[model samples]
Target: MAADDERGRGVLTAADRAYLRGDSEYGSVQAERNARARIRDRIYDALRDFELLVEGLDDRDLDLVFEKRVGEDDGTEAFDALVSTLAFLYRGVGRTDLDFETVLREGVNLAEASEDRGATVDFDVTYHALDADHLLSKLDDDESLSLTEIAYLYESADVTPDELAAYFEDARAPDIEDGRVQSNVTDY
Candidate 1:
């Protein structure tokens, strides 16, 4: 089966984009902030709950699972995003608290609940801050992360807001076009 087309990937609403761009002159800044906060909280909660679903199965090839699931006709990009985000957190952070029994039991319960709610979890923002590359880019460029990004980092990587400022302090700075040769020239 062919893979599902990507939908809602890295897509944000107009209001959200505007707010992130700091366009809050006459609008209710508080209201926009609150709205964005609520959405981010929901996504964070969803990621945590889904994390419970895959708490165990060590040594298993999750990449194969992801590949197979994505090839299914019923699969959606959302599933891909969820699995990718989960894998990133599990692998990148080296979290070893795995319990297959709990995952099996709770996974079913979570699926059932989500089905009843007609897809309660939103996976569109999975690429926001969950991905390592995106998060690193944000840190590398010294850009401010959105609330969703902050929540994902905290939940997935245990990164706190206070630590964000220094997350990349030790990394080499991005190259600049000052047009200079090596500082230490070797004379033969």
Candidate 2:
């Protein structure tokens, strides 16, 4: 009897053509494809729940607040601004035991790393602080976010409100030679 021509069907489909060309056996190809499909299905299922949870949240619930110091004479003013932004974001939502300074340091490190990789990072910091109890209660009841997920959300909020507002405004404004906002002087 002629061997069944399984080409164009099952694991012998073009999807596994490359692997098969590399001398992979038919059984192995089938196993790999099945495993990949299973993994993909699991991820889709997980994302469905995540999407539902996010859909339930109000826009205001996501807002956060941060402080910005302007016109400081200190040389470290810029550095302080960045740290304060990060600290404010991590406050309340972040681990209570973790030192605020540590979170700030990590934010600086992450920002530097992002810059080194030639990636642009844009963040918006909320004016509202994180409510740990509220977050925990939601998580407990909804199971939408894991502890790790919640922690990261709080961690990434490390930007100041003023800086965030400025960043957005700068993004929308037209480019100029000095990159400073144009102001008009009027005599009273």
Candidate 3:
């Protein structure tokens, strides 16, 4: 809940962090890059197996289903991140012979309308990108919080990440001159 609690934390291992942090004078970053590249390749391979189901679908069927799942699940921040990323991918799929742009345009319209009205999506557990793993660990330490409870919290909360980001949009990490992260989570 506090800003100091979340920054500089990650779900990644120290080696991975260091590699992404890019002090590769000794080729550590390169190694990390290679590791990520391998993972990407593997993901591609896996998708190839499911290509028939996953590929060449538009928002009407594919993207709509994805959004429906996200909307149904509510404010699952991390999973939402994944879904958001996937939605972005879906957005990139251009019109095809079988699918037109109408689905994507309509989907975007729906999302914009929902967000404009401040429609709440509940999350049972949620975290900002920089602090997700650390936040999860912290939540784990709470006697009252289980993975299920945390997940519930993520799913139950009505707050959207866009709202969270907007609350802190004007404040940079380096600009904090006082206690806590230099962002107001409560601001309109």
Q: Report the Cα RMSD per candidate.
A: 16.3, 23.1, 16.4
Q: Please provide, for model 3 over 1-188, each residue's C-alpha lDDT reduced to its tens digit, 9 standing for 90 to 100.
A: 23223435433334444555574334587865777886557556654654454434554775566667445553544354575455545544432342324444554555556346433343242534434445445534642333333333233345333332333447443333232221212222
List, residue by residue over 106-186, the lDDT tens digit for candidate 1.
Answer: 556665664464233322224322675677577677776653454355444554434543463442222111211111111
How high is the CA lDDT of each candidate model? 0.47, 0.42, 0.44
Model 3 accuracy (lDDT, Cα): 0.44
Identify the runs in model 3 with alpha carbons over 4 angstroms from their true place. 1-27, 52-74, 78-82, 91-188
Residue-level lDDT tens digits of model 2 in 63-130: 32122223342324444445545454566436477655555565556546534643343545445455
Q: Better model by lDDT, 2 or 3?
A: 3
Top-scoring candidate (lDDT)? 1
State model 1's lDDT.
Answer: 0.47
Instruction: Point to the candidate with the largest TM-score.
Output: 3
Q: After superposition, how far is residue 75 of candidate 2 from its true place, in Å?
A: 34
Q: After superposition, how far is residue 127 of candidate 3 from its true place, in Å?
A: 28
